[model samples]
Target: MNTPAPGPGTLAEQILRGVGGAENVESLTHCATRLRFQLHDGEKVDQAALDALDGVMGTVPQSGDRFQIVIGGAVANVHSKIMNLPSMSGGGTSRPQSDADVKAAVRARGRGRFAWLDNFFEYLSDSFRPLMGVLLGASLIIAIASVLDALGVVDFRAEDKSATWVFVDAMWRSVLYFLPIMVAYNAAKKLKIDPWVGAAVMAAVMTPNFTGMLAKDSGIPGITCTTNATLGTQECVARVFGLPMQLNDYGGQVFVPLLMVAVLALVYKGLQRVFPENVQLVFVPFFSMLIMIPVTAFLIGPLGIWAGNGLGEGMSWLNGNAPIVFAIVIPLLYPFLVPLGLHWPLNALMLQNISTLGYDFIQGPMGAWNFACFGATAGVLLLSIRHREKEMRQTATGALAAGLFGGISEPSLYGIHLRFKRIYPRMLVGCLVGGVIVGVLGGVNTEAFAFTSLLTIPVFSPTGVYVIAITAAFVTSMALVYFSDYRTPEERAQANAERDAAEAAEAAGAVGAAEAAARGEAAVTGDRETVAADDRELVAVGAAGAVAPAAAAAGADAAPTAGSAGEGFALAAPVAGRVIGLGEVEDPVFSSRALGEGVGIEPADGHVVAPADGELVTVADTGHAFGIRTADGIEVLIHVGIDTVQMRGEGFDVRVEAGRKVSAGDLLVEVDLDAVRAAGHPTVTLMTVLNTADVASVEPHAGQDVAAGAPVVTVRR
Candidate 1:
């Protein structure tokens, strides 16, 4: 009685269709929440249709060269299919038509900020932007520092070290390190956000002398700064409670100060609700600082530092206890990095401690893992560069700089990882081969350098035995990259081949429809479409704006004419937004409270309207997201944003439970929008499809506003 949901690939194909098909696309990339792309002809896109998509979050014009589609978590899957979509010549490679267009593509950036925790990743991403500059500074400083220290001009020996060495090592070690924070600050500002406060917190956290203070290096205010018979004198103790802190004079403990600021922001938000705005600012920041600083310093900072140091110690212990097993871990993790970004910070943290840890076992993982992946990406880039397009070469060339030398993986990971999925096995083989060599030969860590390339391969080969193992990593990676049949030469013969193929196929399906389209295919900017759910039981959705009721679909008032509405579908509340976890729930699932694996909602008394108009699928609850399959086979996953799971149900209200059939206008859930707002969160509701491979099109129903019964999305065949 029900059809299976469309696969994620199907949804990608449909998205390509709406965007004038694969040939129309020039190139694509992704951020936290959107699929950023450049189309050969802006006129060919159906902006309204794309926005009206049921699973789509929204659309925005970003920078100068990009048109962005908000697709949330499904972005990666969709991006892959779009890239691999079939073209007339055989492969659908995005090709730009003009030099100016290529230049614009190189310069444009979208104004979206990822989650605060992802700041670590932002640091790495930003590394590529000023890659040459930052690397130059780091390489030159380290190189010069190494030279000076060797020449006896610089010393940190305390007994023999010069003031110059002390100053440079203590202060300059992390000089270009804050590059990540700076990048995020500039990027967020472009998004129109004031990040001065956040940046200030980061600056304090990264301050050279701050770590010492947190480590109890700065004289504890109340505790007497005295010579010790137990342990050592205050001046000699570099650790507190068996915890390590890398700093000169002490004072800046990052976590506590950051916590203070965050708590202060929370206080400001709370007071703004009742107290007058003018009075709240001073009091909020003032009290937040007053309450948080002492608490953080005396408690949080010490605890966090201890935990961090302990973690490092534990890893050290593990490596010391079992060297062989330790050697193989990196190769194993390299393959999984894309799916589970868990160890992303391990490299940075390893670097942070390397100054003291001396030789590291962790470096074993670094050898062939990313290098193999990087080699694979290099192959993809090289292939892209040689393909018959000059404009694409320019962009691919820039991307290769990061992929080849700097080891920033996005351009390679997203650009090549998907294109040559089969190359993964070879990459893994290479990694395992390297790991086996490390484990067998005892490849101890030298020291970590910032670069990840073939030239720097020896640093990883501490025993100077890298002739074969490291070479194996490169040869394997390159072979896989080159041999994997992601595309063929026949495919790159012409530009726009993919688009022409799709158009021709569609033309074959309905000549009459094609004629009608020819008559009305004029592109209209700012157009909107609204229609009722085709069925009584499914919901209809529109963008986040005032919706003209279905009665007005033909009333000539339906805004932005000539826009086509995709087929409709229905959705149900997954969980109450505020409820953190249901009974027996495990893993990260959507909460009714916030996004991640949660179903967020607007609470109040309201009908459970159809999310979009399609036949109902089971309203099963994983206690996270409400899983529903549209009639057209699109699987809709409506999740709330991150970390709302701990709320325990005070954050939101749930109206319709699972399996309640209703029309597009039927109220599904009247949410507690105010409660969520009061709790200080952007109520950006995301209704995404986990299985978007089969979905043909998504129509946006959410606009700048939402009244009752407003259509937010339309899915199509």
Candidate 2:
């Protein structure tokens, strides 16, 4: 009694069921390759069923009732489907939380020794993540303007530029000039504080009244300006209430707002605690603004400015003295840093360099890393096309496009590079090659901060060097990944077999639907309704007709047996055992028949054999299960033991592979029952008809001792 198919429902319905229905899903979210669920009760999830799902690649159960279902490139589609289900209508994608829920969430977030480190990275990522669009937009504007400058159509750096070109400059400059305020707002929101308060405090310093004091001839009292000889930049100080306060331009200064918001959140939340709830909002923002504005202008602002400039100068010194070492280190470090969110500080330094030094040098070498990442994705795309892996091809195509055009690497990083271990080392070699070229040819610099993409190539100085470095990096990574192949040979074979089985199942479904339409029926055979036949025809004249000839040709040796009304088949015991009903099985999913009608066997020994002759459609990597599809379209699932997958093939010797034709009683695997028991897993062998609903009836002959290959289950189509 397999879990009865939810007829006519989409894959989302199946996923919802596998996650223990909508009621169990407290909140839902998705990333590149996985559907993240914060469940109300983790124990209710059907992990085995999810692993067996067609679209799902794997299931990861985390602490605090959190679950992640890996769906590869199709995650977004599957997530949309799940959210659109009628059962999910009561709430939005993320449900409202109660006091208990909040507490539980907090407890769940205690992710061991590095919890603070996790929170820190998450904070950094969220703060900058929202600004990516505007940043990319600004970078592209710079790219176009730089191209015109390079073509001699405009003197972009001239102080006497025409109004039209100056206006053009302002277009991209708007995003960078006010970046501090934007970062402040986002950082405040991430910390659960009043975002407007954070923005106001940072905006105060960038205001005309504040920046007007930077002028040496300003008539304002208690203000003085000086120019640094080394950096050739103006510095100002204002005497406010009989104290000297450093006055610095906060435009395009990300670190200032990042630091200011951290302090503001503390003050805002503290003010909230002091004031009554009704009057708290007004007073909290009031006090937060009052306290943080002065604090930022007098302390945090200068500190953040000095800190950013100090770091930028340090890197500049490294590039000046040892350009080769600096170039090599940056590209190599970025591949690891970006994934961990530790690269945000370096990104801030890049902006700081453009703002203070009027140019940035880091991005030139960094382009190597970006192109290398994209090149590896290209390799995957090529391999996917060769192997006919539709999912990988789709994923790699999108990731490569994002990388090359938008200069965004998260898609390539999370979607493909991280999943395959071999890609990183090969990509690193590309990074090294590109870095060396840039260093040996003299470092490239960009006046305007820009994303390292093909469109932004004009922004870098000495474009030839930059182009050559990136090309070398790209070609190296692409060749290495394509030649070596990402997946091991064994894994590749299994993946191809799974792909073939999925294709076959799709073809069978299409044929079934066409036949149903021909007979003027609205549904396919999957609806589980028996078809009415006219006279006792020797052969079934329907969708099954397509496979009847092959079944007949195989004759008595084949798995199926012709019945009076329809096609039928019998399944044998995979091991010498006493057959027991599914209800007696320890696993609830099987006991409830969610995976269809089946029987469990208490095996006397560990010699597992094939139950029928057909194509072995699926063989689990752990040797715990195998799916056989008969010539007459009977799908049988033979599972070795309860939770034996946890053993990871430690004591099981698998003798068969997927896509192979096997006869009844052919050796499938030899398991060590004692090893399974020692590992605290039950040794009951369960066999079920996965597609029982498609057949007429499936009967189990349980409660009897049976030898290997003895008939134990009967299926009728």
Candidate 3:
């Protein structure tokens, strides 16, 4: 018996089951549209079952036992649902790390050539990803202030700004000024340490008592202050416990926390082992703060400051000397960097530049890349509208909105750009154009760290240059992608055919419902069974009565039709061959009856025909598969060969389009069996009833020689 199709309420449960019943899941997290899972056993995942779920858009299997399920805009809700499931109460929220599990996971992660590199990026990403909402919020506040400053409503830079303005400034400044503590907390959590201990250690230096010593007139003994000639910034040193301490402001410094947490995790875990579980929690955090606070203040603080400054200086020199090259490189590299999570370090640099150098040059050029990405999505959206590709249109619409308004490119990149190969090249061209414009115009700079978005335009200096450059990039990519088209000709045709068939099926369903209502029957739309028949009666599988097509259309009460009784309808063989059970089809999804019960045929020849009279519901672009819905609503799928889609239609001649009416034994495609075999694909043709659960029974007569149009399966309503 088939499992019932999942609805919205059961989507999370189905997804959990699909990924090996929560036990296999190590950890689950979500970005904008996908639920990312780190699983213990990737092999245990049932990709077919998840794909069959209604809410799940698609599934992606990645390296190192990772899986991603795309849920589009509803990802957050679905993720919440999964986490809230009763089965997930134990260890589903995160991986349960026993000694053996940890060792095995480490081995799996270390197997790849660039395993360390992957781990490094993942660490950086997790530390900053949770901070995006706050960061974006702060940036927008800065943008509003910048706009007000531009409009001369109030002098934002005035030393004696009003109390209200200062308070407003504090709203955004609080997030940036205390950013180190936040990063430290997140980083510690990522490393599986006590997060509060990390936050406290970093917070120690940011306190008023420590910063007060920086004032030369504070009258603290053994304290000294100096001014840097090059950067024109004050430096302070103080004596604590008879040792010199570097009393620098740790506010907005991200690198310090990142460095501190790495060292802290080791100390934390070692302490955990040394002390028993009863006393460990209190002593661990107590000792971690005691050791890490001084280490951070005396050594890590100054080192991190120096490191941030040195990197900032390098970028400053590049922008000063080779402005054009620097500008061009920022935009072009961002396209690649953003996908790999390598962009986080550059983002840290942006904050560092704003903190140390008073303004950042990286964001000016990076805007070009962002707008170009949005432009490509716009092109795809326009084409989806033109081609009437409903699913693509919806995807592109949401992705484009997220990009243009939120200044987020993940939706555009992951949802559309990555899937289609043709889009990236065009988007790159736009990035190059925008970068060139910024380079030629003396480059752009922003005093505040802001997302490259239209709302934040005023935050950047030389706004005209930034505006012109981004516009050129957007228009260039949009025009190029729109003109060239995102999909190939064959793909477009196939997509349109699928759309038409879906529409026809929907229309047929509506007619069936109306006919049932007219006959005073309680029309149960969900209970109706549809076969590989077009314009035939849509029977209610377990309902009291079934309606015939002719009688239903005429609004008349009719007796059982030819296909309504238990005697059933015969589905003829599409080709002359020796029939076999679905189990022998050599395809797991088919052999397991996941797509429904059917037969496989070792073809004697290449000619393929319609199994029954119906409208062709779907015709694969690669000419490897067909779906037919009979007049009595039996949806049959005829797949020509195993994995033959990889052949790219090289040896198959298709004779029918979707939505075309056909009869039993009608030629659907001409397949070259030898060519299929040479391409390393099986030549055995397989057929299945797609809506098998909707019918009373589907019985396949296999293990026999069959001629074309010979009855090979019997179906009952």
Candidate 4:
């Protein structure tokens, strides 16, 4: 019989179950290739099930809290699968809570569409996105252009003839002349502005007539004048009172347009403050045109040309003064360039100069390419093959091919490079090593108009040690990753199994001691019963004010000490909200209340803490409650309710943050019924952090009653 296919939720459950259930995952964030998880316990992982998933690419157990899962290009897709789980205490399931699970899940709160969107923006545009197209194009053009120029230069230089030289010179020069227009347009669009305006401005600056005029003996001073002719002599594109005067040629300059647009944006935004929206659009554009055009023409344009020239000249000087340093740094920064978007503007000058003067300065030395995509994918592929999980192995293999031949780099970045946090640093080191090889070779076979990978090596062309450098970089990175990586499946499992056996023996010895002593054994009850049967008991509200003792005589291992808040309603950190001011950890939200009115609420878990002082007014077993009257007088009413109450009991683990003076967004409970549902329960969740009687406006903003910690009624009196 054919095996049943795992649905998204089912697939998610299996993955979570294997990684020590919902308790294992510390927090989750997704990229294009895999789910970036901050996990607490990776040792108990069910590697076989994780390996079995169709989406998983490979696995790497990073040294930090992260457990990297290579899930192909469907990371976001799989994240959707995992998030659909009904939540329990602190993003956990219905399993009895552990302190580690509670503390860890606190990192997962405050994740919303906006937060995700912000991260998504960073994911796509910041470093890698803008130049990917240009990088590819540039690399290809460099190869092609070099060949064309070489054909003529070889013959001309060899025979001292003008014919071949003139033809090559004319064609090469023509493209260079038009190059500024392309850069300006592309840069403008990337900045979210009108491309046509940029193109028009660039075209005006680069016009031969303008160049011809500027070629005057000393230099033509800035005298803004208007000119319409596409081919005119000594004309200015912008005007000073309609007087036609000579001006500097600065077309194709990157920063000129950016400066103009930024100023225009400021004015436009300021106009919105004063004018109505309809007129704001018109007048803003009109005013921006009047202001920015002249400023750009007179000030920004000239400066940009000067700056670009200066930058190019500076780079030129560096190459001359310390060619070795230039070589070393270029490789160091090149790989980083693709990922950080800033590389486009910086590298534009190099490409421009290459177009102007045959072969880039790297033609002598000081050149190299980043082998990130190739090296990372190759490493991933090796891990995939070694993985016992079939689907994960297959995805990894495909991701590798994409990096090698298809020229896409995501597989390399998400699938391989980030497998271990340290790999990022290692890749940078390897890139530099390879860059030295190419930098020293400094012979030009191909010039990149765009960035690309190893297959483009021949384009760098027929012979050169630069080719060897590129190959060496890949080999070096792959080798490093391989060695720096973790043990394979069988090995890790065998080690774990062995350790478990040892632990079991020790436990047996302890048990034997207890048995012999007759009264040495502690009577076990529930999950923690094995630890301490005489545990201090506290309230565990089921649905109503109806409560059960959290544990019969359950004692906190580490109770409040000096400076720690004493137990009142015992806020027990409801739902694992990250505390700031009581600040600590990754990204703190708001600080303590020494100077403040209300405490900040940037909860890490999807649960809320009652301010420790509230009347347990009405609990409907639907998992919602209202608390009142604290020293702060904020009258906090926190309701742990999510969906249709299918997760009624599994919904919340409340300890109370009200009734006692509590700060904002405290962890009072742990709720991850979402995982409970994903673990095969129905999807109904207890919803709302509510308001019973009412207040004018909630001190906090209210939101949809979706999941626990989801905003319900933030009432204000």
Index of the highest-TM-score prediction: 3
Instruction: Report how far residue 11 has shifted in candidate 1, in Å.
Output: 42
TM value for model 3 = 0.53
Clash count per candidate: 90, 7, 15, 73
- Which scores better on TM-score, 1 or 3? 3
Name the runs in model 2 displaced over 4 angstroms.
1-25, 28-113, 136-171, 215-219, 326-433, 440-468, 475-717
The C-alpha TM-scores of every prediction are: 0.38, 0.52, 0.53, 0.36
**Which scores higher on lDDT, 1 or 3?**
3
lDDT digits (tens) for residues 1-717 of candidate 1:
021222245667657766676676677776444676786665666654564455565554333445667676677787777666655233344564589876765554332243443443343333234333443444444544554444556353346566766667655345344543453344333333334533443445446555445344457433223332211223222343454433322132223333344444554356556577678656654554455444444455445444444444455566768777766766656565432223333544565455556555575556567666666655655655554333334444544565445444444543445343455676777777777777788765756544454434556646455546656676677677667633544544333232222222222122222222322332232111110111101111111110111111222111222444555443433322322121112211111101111123442332234555544453312111233555555555543332222222344444445555544454444445465566664454445443322344333332223443444444444
Candidates 1 and 2 compared by lDDT, better number = 2
Residues 1-717, candidate 4: write the lDDT tens digits: 122233366667666665666656667766445566676665665543454354454443444545556565566777777777764235543334589878766655434446665443343333233333343433334345444444443432234646856575455344433545554455455555555555555565556755655543534454345432211223344334764433665532334544554455465466657888777656755665566666666676666544543444456677668877776766675555433223333444555555655445442222334464467456656754553334335545655554555344544554444333445666666677776775666534445433344344454543467667666767877777667653445554553432222222222223223322322222221222222111000011111111111111012121222442322222222343322211221111011111111112334444555544445443323233334444433333333332212333345565643234434454455566465546453222111222211222222222212222333322333
Mind sharing the TM-score for model 2?
Answer: 0.52
* Residue lDDT tens for model 2, 257-359: 8878888888888898899999986888888888889999999988876665454456668877898899988889788766533454466667667877888
User: Worst ten-residue run, lDDT, model 4?
Assistant: 533-542
Total backbone collisions, model 3: 15
Ranked by TM-score from best down, the candidates are 3, 2, 1, 4
How much lDDT does each candidate structure score?
0.45, 0.74, 0.74, 0.44
lDDT of 1 at 208: 53
